[model samples]
Target: MHVVITGANRGIGRALAQGYAQAGEDVTGTARSGDDGPRLDVTDPESCAAFARGLGDRAVDLLVCNAGVYPDKGQNLDTGYPPEMWAEAFATNVTGVFLTVQALLPHLARATAPKIAIISSQMASDSRAPGGSYIYRASKAAALNLGRNLAVDLGPRGIAVGIYHPGWVRTDMGGDAADIGAAEAAKGLMSEFTALSLASTGAFRTWDGQDHPF
Candidate 1:
């Protein structure tokens, strides 16, 4: 199988790319700087388009939308989440995913059972709201909603979409105090991605396979 993963230069994204490559699957890992792999600025429409053109009609069985930003991680409740922070967060965390999918639709259509995996966060859930990191939370929520709707629209074309929380992983973004290691989270997420299908599309699931509350 051929898989394309965004933000794969490090963290959970890197682990996921390694796991798939080790399994003998073809993997294309993209990053914005091009130091790790192909350069892809998910927030830029022109970048996404260029990346798709570079693929040259190659079929992508799995497209993982793992690129995101959590700029408001520890912002003050009163003065935090500035307008620019919100804009940047949504541009990378939400709009980026949509642009990536839109650019790859034709390549995905060439696959037998194409699937899109969105890496949203549990914090996106309304029931899980504890009130901090407003920008990140709202952006993730939008990504989750986008994935669900994409699932509905793409199901008829044999494309499935699954949104997931990749667990509190120990990474640059997730922090050292996080609950799980990147490898473990990547392994579990690969399992979840593998299990995705038209019947189970639009599910908000955890990396460990449990259904997450929307």
Candidate 2:
């Protein structure tokens, strides 16, 4: 399978790339600097378009929209979450995913069974509100909604879309106190991506293959 993953310089994106490559799958892991495979700034429309063009007529069996930002991680709700931070967060986490998907839609359509994996967070869940990090939470929620709608629209075209929480990973972004490692998350996500089909196109799931509340 040919897989395209974004933000693969480090963390879970990197792990997913390594795992897939080891499994003998064709993997294209993209980073902003192009240090990994290709240069893909999901926040920029032209960047995404150029990356797709570089792929030529090759099929993208899987598209993993994993690039994201948590700009207001520790910001206080009373005096934090500035408008600029919100803009940055949405640009990377929300619009970025959409642009990546839009740019690669043709490549995905060329595949026999295309699958789009959107790496969202449990923070996006409206049912589990704890406040703080307003920008990250709101952006993730937007990403989740985007995946849902994309699944509906893309299902008839033989594409499957799934939004998932990669779990609290012990990476630079997740901190040292997280619950899982990048490898473990990648393994589970690989299975989730493998199981994704038109039947469960809009499913919101955890990395461990459990259903996640929207």
Candidate 3:
């Protein structure tokens, strides 16, 4: 399968890209550095659009929206999250995905069964989190909604949109004490993606295939 993965420099995105590439699948992995290719600053619509075009006429079987940032510099709910932080988070985690999907729709349409997967967080779910994550949580929650809405709107186009939580993965973002390793998380995520069908569109799921609440 031909796949496009964002944030490939490190963490879960890097692991997933390596996993697919190791499996002999054609893959395009984007990162901030030119180590793989040019930087994909997700906050820039032009960058996202250009990246989609870079895929050429190849029908992308999967597009993994994995680029994000969690600026947990000195955060606390008691201090209140700033609107600028929220905006920054949304620019990368939500609007970036929207633009990426929009630009790739044409290429994706040519595929037999195109899939769009957004890397979401369990903290995004209102039912899952009692508090914290402030800006990051809000942004991911918006991402979930976008994925679900796309699932409905793009259903007729034969594209499957899935929201995936990779679990508490041990990455730079996840910290050292995270429960799951990047390789294990990547394996589980691939398993879930492989098992996905048109019937499962609009579903929020974990890397292990467990259904999550909206």
Give residue 84's error in model 1 in angstroms. 0.6
TM-score of each: 0.99, 0.99, 0.95
lDDT of 3 by residue, 1-214 (tens): 8888888788999899999989999888888565765567787877877776777788989989998888754597678677888888889889988988888899889899999999998988989776677788888999999999999999999999899999999888899999999999999999888877689988899988799887
Per-residue error for 182 in candidate 2, Å, reads: 0.4
Model 1: clashing residue pairs?
A: none
Model 1 segments beyond 4 Å from truth?
Answer: none
* Residue lDDT tens for model 2, 142-185: 99999999999999899999999999999999999999999999
Per-residue alpha-carbon lDDT of model 1 for 9-110, expressed as tens digits?
A: 999999999999999999999999999999999999999999999999899999999998899988998777789999999999999999999999999999
* TM-score ranking, best first: 1, 2, 3
Better structure of 2 and 3 per lDDT: 2
Off by over 4 Å in 3: none
Best model per lDDT: 1
Query: Which pairs clash in model 3?
Result: none
